[model samples]
Target: MGHVFGAFTVLVCALFGVVITANGITVDVNDEVSIKSAARIVADGLMNYYHGNESGRIPGVFDGGYYWWESGAAWGSMLDYWFFTGDDTYVEVAKEGMLFQVGTDWDYMPKNQTLSLGNDDQGFWGITAMMAAERNFTNPSSDEPQWLALAQAVFNSIALVWDSQYCSGGVRWQKFVFNNGYDYKNSISNGVLFQLGARLQRYTKNETYGYWAEKVWDWESTIGLIDNTTSYVYDGGSIETNCQVLNKIQWTYNMAVYMAGAAYMYNYTESDTWKTRLDNLINTLDVFLYGNTNVLYEPACEPSASCNVDQQSFKAYISRWMGATIQLAPYTYNTLFPMLTTSALAAIRTCNGGLDGVTCGYTWLTGTYDGKYGLGEQMAALEVLQSQLIPYTVAPYTNDTGGTSIGNPNAGTGVLGSQTSSATSQTKDKAGAWIITCVLSAIAILTSIWMAMDGKGEAKKLQEWIRVESNYA
Candidate 1:
């Protein structure tokens, strides 16, 4: 695969006596595009009609059928964008996609969402709806059946897959015990449940959620699915291996889903164990997943063609949940944001014209365009770019506990003001006005210098030149 590299100069700009550093300033000229607009372009390309249906669910391949997991991942990231930035333009589209996936019981089942056969896959849609659940959605679906209830039913389905037969307890990859992948118990399925449990625990103060949270964490921790030594989450253990050996593929989302789970656990329990575990997992990511230029990447398939359709969307959660963890645990801001910011800027630079004609790709490290366009690629890119919206996103949520949230004091409004572009003619007009103001300010300074020189005639000439320049502007 060919690679594309853009020269980036990371800047730590101090505005009004406070230092702002979440997704630091990148000198990549392409960075000037509107983040929201890029997200919309990505959606337009990827969320087209799939399987001859007119739903907003993002397709897996270009003009192709829907993959339950990928579409869920895309919706999750899109809602994250709306939540993270408080921009609701994507809400209607996200609602349609989400609504299409939920079954009659509101569970994400194959009866509704296609190929939603695996427990982990169903868990994805449930977890995606939780984002809506946490917020007060004014839409009809928000109250039609209650988003949290939907999330709970999905949780119920995922919990049904737990088998003590494997390492005392772990979720089967497939729902049925007789299925081919049923013997496989992976991190994502179980980890998402742990995440849901923790979040529900925090939101509802229900000990039942806490119970499940601790149960899954205990099982994963005890079985070494999360390496006790390294804290990196291994893929899964199969019945073929007697659930004794771990896959240890180390996908970015496997680690991140756990990071997010631990973060919610921290918010709910404030337990040092969860904090320590989350910290250790982040350290593991730094060592393993942090790649060229200290940006995020999958070790097995970057700068190469090995990453399959499913593997392409892994980092979206890393960008989403890692940012979420920061909201819940402010102590991690300095350590995590710089790396995340690099990846975010890399994503923005990958867009065709920053905001215009954006088609995001799966690979972030290449020096040239990889030319792969699909729902997975767009969602992965959307995740990183939307992550830049975290500073704004975290502020409102942090207020949940109290007015003062755990983050940079001025981060929310400051960084958000700097990063957001409206993607309209109004923005171009503002740029033009700023340039005119700058030129006028320069002219005024020059006029003052000439007056100090005791040359009235020369000052007049300077005034005429300034007037001519303004007319040209």
Candidate 2:
């Protein structure tokens, strides 16, 4: 009987341990899947941007023919994928894309000159360059001097346009404006600066880069442009001072870039303060941009009662923002997945499986829906979905299979159809749930084992003491 009890106890303890381990593994797998989906989105987006010729330099005709500026963002996504997956293909894709961006050999650029480097453009390119420098510098193919030089040149141009006055440190819209000493402090411009500073710090190990990043944060924070009161970030600030900026004007693309840049900065600096700031920004933005209430509001044309302009609705803003969020998933915290999932689902519903059906006022009607429908919307959705799926230990149901529909007819009506049944959708939900369950179970089992082990040790000690007493008697 004692032996049986002991064996039972041992089994229970072992089972508990297994549960704990399984739970942890599940959580990690979920995170891995999210990271993978992010990487694939980046790669596919970049490929589309470069090779997609349906309507000129426009990548895909989905999101209302909108220029998502995803190429630079994709680089960051691919870098994250390479880091987590340890896949050479992802690394190669990243290297090739970055090279293509700066390569003078492309048909887009003049043979004598490289791509036209703009501050916003270069800021993003700089991120890709820094990631490349960190990961692929050892490989001869990735050690392209021209790409590095172009990236640096872009940074130099951006730095030259930094205006010290006007609101701490902020970037100009263009180098020409900086050369002329015209510093206009737009939120987008500052967002670019914030990301660039963080990326530079990572690549060069320069404190100044981080310092500049913080400066941008400080400037935005003081103005209440970024969510100082909450944990998430908002969209651009008002064009006119005293014009009421909607707290819920959380555009997806800007928030993604901002969060990604902030997260990257936090990772490199290990700054708890930064992390706190990032958390606050993310929470606030998620509530505003993605919450069920649809808190999104467009910019008012003027503060007067007569100047009420609805501005762009939530759907329009999401078309742009979703792309950015997908690209930055790698650098941000794991909690981003839930928010991303919500957003993707919402987008799919709104567009109803047809890109044209989505009147996001941006990228639509320019490309084929392929089999999934809603080409541009699907592109962004796939990017997010792909990013989430790539790093799992278990295979995620990717919509890579041919017959899946992209949008939903009853989506905005609050009813999702079969597209919800697609492998991508099911796999994402499964992966997330599986990880959560596994991790929680594992933790519970581990705790049980520890308790059982303690009890067994106590029992053994008591037995030894009783035996000694009996022998002495």
lDDT against the true structure, per candidate, is 0.60, 0.40
User: How well is each residue in 1-473 modelled by candidate 1, as lDDT tens digits?
Assistant: 13333322211121111211212222321332355555555545455423324455232212454466767777677667666546677576567656656656556674644433777887887777667656544333322434555665666556544556436777767765334465567888898888877876565444555677788888888888888887878777765555687766677888888898888888768889889988898888764433346667777665456666777777777888878888888888898776677676666545452223455656666522356656677777677766655565443221244221111111111111121111222343244334433443454455346435743232111233234323322
Clashing pairs in 1: 3-367, 3-368, 4-366, 4-367, 4-368, 5-367
The CA lDDT at 142 in model 2 is: 25
Which one is best on TM-score? 1
TM-score of 2: 0.50
Residues 1-473, candidate 2, lDDT per residue (tens digit)?
A: 33234234323432343211111111111454544443343334334434433435323211333322345554555554455455556455455555555534211122222223345544655555544444343232323333333433444445444544334445544334212212224465567768756654544444555766787788777766675656445443322222144333444445556666776676677778867766665664543331232222112211111111112222332332332333333444355554444333333222222232332111111111123222233344434334344334221111241222221111111122222222244453334324333443454466456535654232111233234323322
User: Which 10 successive residues of model 1 have the least lDDT summed?
Assistant: 405-414
Clashes within 3 Å, all models in order:
6, 50
Q: Identify the runs in model 1 with alpha carbons over 4 angstroms from their true place.
A: 1-66, 112-116, 139-143, 288-292, 353-357, 395-473
